[model samples]
Target: MLPQPNRQMALAQYRLRARFYDAELAAFEPVRLRSVGCLQLQPGNTVLDVGCGTGLSLELLHKGVGPQGQIVGIEQSPEMFDLARRRVARHKWRNVTLLNAPVASATIACQADAALFHFTHDILRHPDEVRHVVGHLKPGAHVAAAGLHWGAPWDWPTNWLVWMAAMYSTTSLEGLAQPWSHLLQHLGAVQLVPSPIHGVFIVCGKVLSTGSEVVHHV
Candidate 1:
């Protein structure tokens, strides 16, 4: 059986990452958003950002959803959560709410127009918990995940950092990308994204439900 991590460990892992999360993902969005336009968004959408540390992506998501839309970001790490909450609050993000909890445990109080589980997928210690993320989805919502693989390059210094991370108890997400496509099959996501990007791959897919509209391969 796959070993699952408790909430405490998960939080600690993110707290460590929060310190460097923004720097690591700085150049990621432009390349990452290549998959965003494919979600076929409209006005008045609600989005769920799993493992949404420090609200780094809150601004972009809010704009994408528009004034009539809403955004929710869930993060388990208290320190990270506090930092994210402060970032959003200081920015006066009226349309956004940040929650402290595991995304898999997040309650679906609101239906989402889209959902995202980003680099966090690789950090998930348990496979079933990864699958549990599906429970929080809204009907026919757009979903995507960005995962890193062996092919992603690291310079000597960063490579050394990666090695140290692997020795740690958490957030050492090795071998996460290879299994990500399996989720596309499990979730029955249509127009699923392709693999083979520079160190990481962003996979896109749509949730299909009644009254289907359109699909994009971003």
Candidate 2:
């Protein structure tokens, strides 16, 4: 197992990168589109954008959920949340709420219809965080996530790309081979697909009944 990320280290990392985050993530927009599509959101639906860095997924999610729909974004980094808050303000989006706290400790008042976890590798590795977020979803709510992962051993080029991306974005490199596995513990069986990019993956599934046992990690 990869060493669990130090919260302070992760915060510091995003604090420095928040300004350039949107620009740096431009190349992965297509993957974001694909991940959001898996949600199949409907009008007036409530969705949770976990680790919603710089609010990159906000507009697409808003488009899916519509004005009547509510979007709650959970972002731990203050610097990143500031940009996201500005984006919401600039857009005059009244239906959105931004939570400036880590997912494991954040309070999500309403049960959401769907949740998105685009590019949230570190969050995915923490089973407690996964369970806490999934617990707020209604049964059968759609959940989709996209992030980096290691490719096959022979796929050296892809692995290199994954390494570079993970080193820059994640606090630790644990679970790069199966970043979505912890999520599957709560989601049951997810339909996982790899993007054309060698070390990228998208996993989509619905929440099982509340009685389903959720695996908890410390």
Candidate 3:
């Protein structure tokens, strides 16, 4: 059986990585941009940033939504959230809201037009967490996710890279082969976009309206 994700372990992990998180993620900045681009946000739209760490994606998301749009970031680690809070404060982004809580239980006040889950493997592994985020989306709202995953069985080099990154960032490596599967359950017309880097993927889809069927395109 796959090991379940441990919240306390994740919290402890981020406590140590928070200070250096942004620097560590520098190489994946392109992936972050692609994920936000998949959202296709518009002015006055509200977007949720799931597991937003140190607000690295905030600038891109803010630019996508513009000053009129709203950005709600949900994070569980106090250390990470503090940096995110400071980032928002530094830029004086009035429309961004930071919620220091787990994604499954965070009190998301708005029905967002889109949600972005960039490199949030642990959150995507939890069905309850994915459902909770999907439940707050407006019908036909866009959803985008990007993260590391196990490569083909013979691709040991790529898999090694993924393992090194996942060990540092995620509490559980379960479901790494198809990390976005749970999130896709509540979405329709899914499209899996290939990333430039091996062992990484970017998925874009829209929320399934009542009675809508799920469709996936590679």
Work out the TM-score per prediction: 0.75, 0.94, 0.98
The top-ranked prediction according to lDDT is 3
Candidate closer to the true structure by lDDT (higher is better), 1 or 3: 3
| Ranked by lDDT, top first | 3, 2, 1
Report the error of model 3 at residue 59, Å.
0.6
Q: Which portions of model 1 show Cα errors greater than 4 Å?
A: 1-9, 122-128, 152-177, 189-197, 210-218
- Candidate lDDT scores, in order, read 0.63, 0.90, 0.93
Clashing pairs in 1: 152-199
Pairs with backbone N, CA or C atoms under 3 Å apart (clashes), candidate 3: none
Local accuracy of candidate 1 as per-residue lDDT tens digits, 1-218: 33334567666666687777777667667645655555556678888777777777677777688888888888878888888888987988788877787666666577677877666644343465555665556666777766554343545554454445443534445443353544554344455455434445566676655566544442
Q: What is the lDDT of candidate 2?
A: 0.90
Q: Cα miss at 79, model 1 (Å)?
A: 1.4
Residue 93 accuracy (lDDT) in model 2:
99
Q: Model 2: runs farther than 4 Å from truth?
A: 210-218
- In model 3, where do residues sit more than 4 Å from their true spots? none
lDDT measured at residue 148 in model 2 versus the true structure, 0 to 100? 92
lDDT of 3 at 191: 96
Give per-residue CA lDDT, model 3, range 81-122, as digits (tens). 999999999999999999999998999999999999998999
TM-score of 2: 0.94
Q: How high is the lDDT of residue 35 in model 1? A: 52
